[model samples]
Target: MTDVTLMDFHADWCGPCKTQDPIIEEIEEDYDEVTFEYVDVDEEPDIANEYQVRSIPTIIVKNEEGVVERFVGVTQRDTIEDALSQAGN
Candidate 1:
C-alpha cells in the first residue's frame, strides 16, 4: 500500500479557508502518519488548476497510487478523520 497525502489548497485572504486551516492543523496532530501539504492558490495557480480547484479550501486526499477523495469548501473534522483512517494514516 502507498502512503497517503492530504493536499490543502487555499489563499491567504479567504475567509472559509481560514476556517479550514485550523481543522487541518488539528488533524495533523492526530494523524501524524498522514502527510499534509498546503498550497497557496495565488502563488501556485498551475497546481491548483491542475487539481481542478474551482473553489477555495479544496482538500484532496491522495495515496501514492492515486487520489482517494476530495473535499471542497469547509470540510468537517469527522469526515476528514474518517478519510485518514481509510487511507491507513
Candidate 2:
C-alpha cells in the first residue's frame, strides 16, 4: 500500500485558512498514518500554480507514488480519512 500525504495549500492572509489550521492540527494528532504538509502560496508559487489552487484553503491528498485522489477546499475529517483509506489501499 502507498503512504498518504496531505498537502494544505494556503495563503497567510486568508482568514478561512487560519480557521482551518487548528482542525488540521487535530487531524495530524488523530491520524498517525497521514502525513501533513503545509505550503504557503506566497512562498511556494510554483506549487500553488501547478495545483491550480486559486482558492485560499485547498487540500490535496496524494499517495506515495504522487497521484492525487482528493482536491478541494477546506477539508473535513471524514473527507481526509476517506482519502487516507484510498491511499492505504
In terms of TM-score, which candidate is strongest?
A: 1
Q: For model 2, give the 10-residue run with minimal summed lDDT.
A: 67-76
After superposition, the stretches of candidate 1 with alpha carbons farther than 4 Å from their true spots are none
Model 1, C-alpha of 46: deviation from truth (Å): 1.1
Q: List the residue pairs that clash in candidate 2.
A: none
Clashing pairs in 1: none
Write model 1 residue lDDT over 1-89, tens digit each, in one string.
45889999999999999999889999999877789999999999999989999999899998876788899999999998788777764
Candidate 2's C-alpha runs over 4 A off are: none
Provide the RMSD of all predictions against the true structure, rounded to 1 decimal. Answer: 1.4, 1.6
lDDT of 2 by residue, 1-89 (tens): 66888888888898888877887888889878778889999999999899888887888888867756655666677777787788778
The CA lDDT at 35 in model 1 is 90
